[model samples]
Target: MAKKLGLKQKYQMMTRGLGWDTTYQSMDKVYPFDKFEGIKVHDWDAWEDPFRLTMDSYWKLQAEKERKLYAVIDSFAQNNGHLGISDPRYLNAVKLFIQGVSPLEYMAHRHFAHVARNIRGIGPAVAAQMQSLDELRHAQTQIHTISHYNKFFDGIHEWRHMHDRVWYLSVPKSFFDDAVTAGPFEFLTAISFSFEYLLTNLLFVPFMSGAAYNGDLATVTFGFSAQSDESRHMTLGLEVIKFLLEQDEANVPIIQRWLDKWFWRGYRLLTLVAMMMDYLLPKKIMSWQEAWEMYYEEAGGALFQDLARYGIKEPMSAAVARKEKNRLSSEAWAIFYQYTHAAAFHTWDIDEEHKAWLAEKYPETFDKLYRPRLDFWEKEAAAGRRFYNNALPQLCTVCQIPMGFTEPDDPTTICFRESEYKGEHYHFCSDGCKGIFDNEPEKYVQSWLPVHQIFQGNCGGASVEDVLKWYRMNLGADNLDFSGSPEDKFWSEWHRTASRAEAAE
Candidate 1:
């Protein structure tokens, strides 16, 4: 074998060295100027992607990864859902994970497809294409893997439509839509840099590791596959930021504002991920507090420190987010508990072990504030009936999560704030999401809250089963309504199989 080139070296050669032309070719002719903005680019060679794998090696690795991944997915499906340690109740976390993240992968595909087309430089453009394809693969593989769960549960169907139209779905949607609508440079800063490069480790790694812990092999595999691509995307983000900053001084403030807004926005969306990591996934990987401590508090803190030398200040709201991250896992878990009836997954009362974990992870404010609520819910659960509230809380017009989050420093009660524009009242979960809404209420107002959709008679039918059927959900016997329905047959059969396996063992 020849002496190996590192990823950085390959990236430098394929993307960075592409524009190293010595001959007198007019730079403007080579990189045509677009008059969308007044920014002038004197040299395009300054653009560089840090992770340097070219098309051939990129596709080869991705293909091999997918081959291995799909083999595991198929094997897991054939062997029944792989996590023996994970009870059905644990899938509530899975449902939320699929809901919050898988769809975003698809959105990444779409937006990256656009980015691949729009970027002016060939090297960056090609890299964008690789990322674009990677994202599309991620979306497909996620959906395929999760579709197995769809056969057994009711959570993931209609996610694309739900993403566009559902209320809670709006939290992520509004964040991405904002990035999509912004100018090209700002879009890069908003999505590629702040959201992907800086914060993605916080979002994906813990969950993947947790999936492994929880016996969710498929999810773990998919998470890893997507994350491998994320490193490249992060490189693109870093490159975009440096390239934009070096190109012109005026772009700094614009990039800075985009950084601030998207960082907070992306951070808020990761709240769902935090909850999933802490309370949703069985055999918890790492606490949100721990992940935040490592990823955001340590890695992000260092990155911001590094950027400080460039006059790129830390996001204005990062401190508040860091403070909230300490408490948001349990806080968000409460929201998930209150609302999971509407989700495809089921939520169980937080047990003693989980409570202990919470206490350890959140030393400052776990038992004193949140335990009482868990106790009450547990008591209600133990008393024969699991409390499944059907009432839909009014969703924020933008973020779409129910109005359950309280103001910072006061997590004891729900917080709801509204703004009036012309005639209509637009609701927001917090000042951050609210500020985003107020800045562009017209855009946020166009959101499709799924609860609102159900109320509006836009979904398929009057009954839950009809709605499920309408949404293309194919419920199996085990996942069928335990309340005496035909779908219960699957559960009966699964139980019978479990009985046989136990008896055999």
Candidate 2:
């Protein structure tokens, strides 16, 4: 070889020289979508990608990761790995992954594609392009890794339809829809900064750790593979935040506002995940409170300190979020326990051992605020009358969760906020949601509230069964109480046969 090119020079050669000016066509006409958002970008050349990833290296490394991931997935299937899980209940975590999270990967891919096309800078555009490819890979790998479970599990089939039509699934769907529909700068701040940099570890780490703890080889493999890509995404997120802040002093307030809005939005969405980690996993890895403290409170606190130099402060609801972490998972599990009949996933009464675990994890609030209610329900379930809230629940206008969250301060009383816009009443679960609604009334007013659609004769018919049918639910299998369900019966028989074989041996 005559000479070897350095990484920085290669990146510059690949990215910088790809743009040119035209005397006949103005740059504004060429890049019309970038300017209208009131964002002041003084110098596009200042945008930098920290990863220094070129397309050739990106493809080579990604292909190697895929080869190894597929090898593990193949091994898992050949080894009858489903039987090796800690418990059948652990599959519920994977079910939620397929139904709730996998589609979001696809949505991220779409929005990042938009950003890559519309954003003006060469460096940022290249980074967005890489992230777009990463997201698409994540979606495919997640589906492929979990498809093995679909062969033997309920609630996993028809997940694509459920993601769009279900009541609870609306939480995540609405979140991404709001972000993708926003302007480019807002989308970057909302997703790249607020979601990826600030909150992604909270979402990804627990689920992956739970999978590893529960002997889910395929999910663990896929999770690690996706996480490798997430490190790059996190770098992109931090770079974009700093770039936007460094671009103009005026960009600070706008970014802070987006941070506040998306942080709360992402936190509310993660409540479902918190419940999954604490209540759904058979072999608990860590309590949701511990994970929150480790991921968000500790790491996120330091991040805000670093950003403080740039005039960025913590989100407005940071205090409330910290306080609520103690009770968030318990309250969320209680809602799911009661309304699981309307859900595709399964839930059952918490046994005494599990209750003891909860008490230890949430000593301050479990018995005082949440346990009494769970105890009463446990008693009712013992008497052969499992509780299921059949009536529709009012969803918050912005977050779209049921109006079941307690007041931030009291934790005993339900936190319900209402606003009147153009003589129309809109409901919210908390002050944060209410503030978001008040700021963006017109956008939220057009929300496709699932419960409201049921009452409007728009979602199937007025009956719960009709709506379930429309949701593509597998009745007596996917929905209703998990006690004595087919899955429970299968687990019982599986263990009994194993015992017999061991005794015979």
In terms of lDDT, the poorest run of 10 residues in model 1 is: 477-486
| C-alpha TM-scores of all predictions | 0.84, 0.97
Across 415-489, the per-residue lDDT of candidate 1 in tens digits comes to 778899879878877777777777767777777776777778887766665655555544442222233333334
lDDT of 2 by residue, 418-495 (tens): 999999999999878888889889999999999999988988998889999999998999987778778888878877
* Cα lDDT, all candidates: 0.72, 0.88
As a whole number from 0 to 100, the lDDT of residue 220 in candidate 2 is: 91
Please list the Cα RMSD from the true structure of every candidate, rounded to 1 decimal place: 4.6, 1.6
Candidate no. 2 TM-score: 0.97
Candidate 2 pairs with clashing backbones: none
